[model samples]
Target: MSGCVFCRIVAGSVPSFQVVGEPSGVAFLDSRPVFRGHVLVVPRPHLETLTDLPEADLAGYFGLVRRVAAAVESGLDAGGTFVAMNNRVSQSVPHLHTHVVPRTKGDGLRGFFWPRTRYDDDGQAATYAARIGAAVAPPTRG
Candidate 1:
């Protein structure tokens, strides 16, 4: 954790473009943003991947992500939000974090992430959402 950049940032050993700093986690503007108002939210304690994060911390970590997402949406007046996280493979940092990117319609964000597929219809979309929702465990009390 000591040599990890995120951990160093959380420890105040490294300077970051901090947006919000909370006991639960820290939110900061991405130094290399895909677009304007790109933010990253990271847990205070070092975690290498999503699976490494403790269940007890999910609510608070996700609460911070939600808060940052709202800020990205409202602050930039974006049409919507793009929230994502990579695991061990594409993850540049070994720490657990989430990317909250402000998105606008027709912004020309192409293939690497754009052109999202839509469900065949509302029913199919609902089914997929429900399936993932059903697997979600309720947040445990801290």
Candidate 2:
């Protein structure tokens, strides 16, 4: 896991625009965002691909992801959110990460053809992270 970028980010060795840092996982702004407030949620420990995730970790990891999706929508004042995960195919980092992207009507995003965008600077990225981070509420059990 030493060479894993997600592991480095989770370990605080590699800097990222972190939104949620918790026992369950870490959520951060995607460097190449599909939208300004796009966030990627990954488990605290390294796990490559979704199937690699253990059954015991499912609830906690997904609870974190659910919270992030809500935060992205509410914090960014977006109409809704698009949450997705790529297993082995098109799995850019070879890490178990879920993408939570803010979406609004008429945004022009269609299907899987995601056109990536960048923040104006690190400050801009941080701003996005802070916005979503602030709105993220503590997880509640059903």
Candidate 3:
């Protein structure tokens, strides 16, 4: 956590193009922008992954992300938005964070376009969404 770059940003040891800074979280423009108005939202506390974060912190972190997304949408006139986060195996910073990207029609950002069998109908898509949603539901205790 001490050596982590995001931690340093949160600690004010490093400079960032910060957009929003709150007691629970911070939002900043991404140096490596996937699209214009790209932002990164992170909790103040050091956390390696979403599972490592306390529920309250995680909620507050995403709440900030949503707020940033809204700002980007209105300011940039983006047609859509992409929100993402990578865990240990795919993370670059080794710290928990979310990416809020303002997407346009021809952004050239192809997400998860793996070759796969096509779904037969809307039922298949609905079923897939429902299952994934249930699996990712927040802990009942939290």
User: Per-residue alpha-carbon lDDT of model 1 for 87-112, expressed as tens digits?
Assistant: 98879898988987668898888645
Q: What is the lDDT of residue 55 in candidate 3?
A: 75
Q: Where does candidate 3 have its weakest 10-residue lDDT segment?
A: 132-141
lDDT of 2 by residue, 20-108 (tens): 89999999999999999999999988898888889998999999999999999999999999999999889999889999999999999
TM-score for each predicted model, relative to the true structure: 0.77, 0.97, 0.75
lDDT of 3 by residue, 5-65 (tens): 9989988898766666777687766666665456788988888888988875766667677
* Candidate 2 whole-model C-alpha lDDT, 0 to 1: 0.94
- By lDDT, the better pick of 2 and 3 is 2
Please give the clash total of every predicted structure, in order: 0, 0, 0
Give the distance in Å from residue 60's predicted Cα in candidate 3 to where it truly belongs: 1.6
| Superposed model 2: Cα runs more than 4 Å off | none
- C-alpha RMSD of candidate 1: 12.2
Candidate 1: lDDT of 68?
71
Off by over 4 Å in 3: 112-142
